[model samples]
Target: MKISILCVGRIKEKYWNDAIDEYSKRLSRYCKLEICQVADEKTPDKAPEALENQIKAKEGARLMAKMDPAALKVALAIDGKKLDSPGLAAGIEKAGLSGISHIQFIIGGSLGLSEEVLRASDKRLSFSDMTFPHQMMRVILLEQIYRAYKITSGEPYHK
Candidate 1:
């Protein structure tokens, strides 16, 4: 299985990159773990909140285009469905059994993902209802993905 993490914005913090890289390496044993970074949209200094989302939407489209059409898309958003470790493991197992060749996890910019991307996704998952910075979210997502793989493979990483 190929697990691709598509995210908006670069990991500017060294710590964030280091943490995500650690999990990415761990996940590679179970499947291909790839991280795709897209340019973050610039927040207009004078735009209203509604207009801000439009900027994010434009960038979201670019990110969506980079994803493989055959892959199972999972967009990360605050309003998305929340799942625990076990639930995530179950979803991965089902995907694997279903012969999903790839799984693309989309992470939007500061304003969140556009409706089009959300509609294109097979699943929408939220780490929490509380908002997180996009950079931090990358590391968190990577860790959870590694843990999920460990859980499925009977590996000791999860414990």
Candidate 2:
């Protein structure tokens, strides 16, 4: 099994990097884990819809190029379906059993994903209805993934 997180922007803070490193290390025991960070386009000072869409399109293109075409692509969206840990584990296991070994998760930038990228995704997953910082989302995503693996393997994980 292989898991890839195709997220926009880099983790500049040391604490964020450290947390990701720790989760990545633990997750390595379960399967191949890759963190693909694409450069986030700078938002314009004017912040017009046209400019926002253009930036999203550029970022979306980069994200699409980085992922495997055959992998199951799941986009993180605010309006996406939210799943519990067990449900997440089951979904991943089912996909694996069905021969989809590679699972790539797409986390969009500040302005969110483009329509093109969202349409290309196989599933849209959400952690909550509330908005979160895109960078912070990465950490939460990693932790959930780690928990999912533990659940699948019947290991001890506290609620």
Best by lDDT: 2
Native-structure RMSD, model 2: 0.9
- Model 1 Cα lDDT, one tens digit per residue, 101-129: 89999999888898889888989999997
lDDT of 2 by residue, 1-159 (tens): 999999999989999899999999999999899999999998978798999999999999999899788999999999899999999999989999999999999999999999889999999999999989898999999999899999999999989
Candidate 1, poorest ten consecutive residues by summed lDDT: 150-159
| Candidate 1: segments with Cα more than 4 A from true spot | 157-159
Which candidate achieves the best TM-score against the true structure?
2
Residue 44 CA displacement from its true place in model 2, Å: 3.1
- Name the 10 consecutive residues with the lowest summed lDDT in model 2: 42-51
Please state the error at residue 37 of candidate 1 in Å: 0.7
- For model 1, name the residue pairs that clash: none
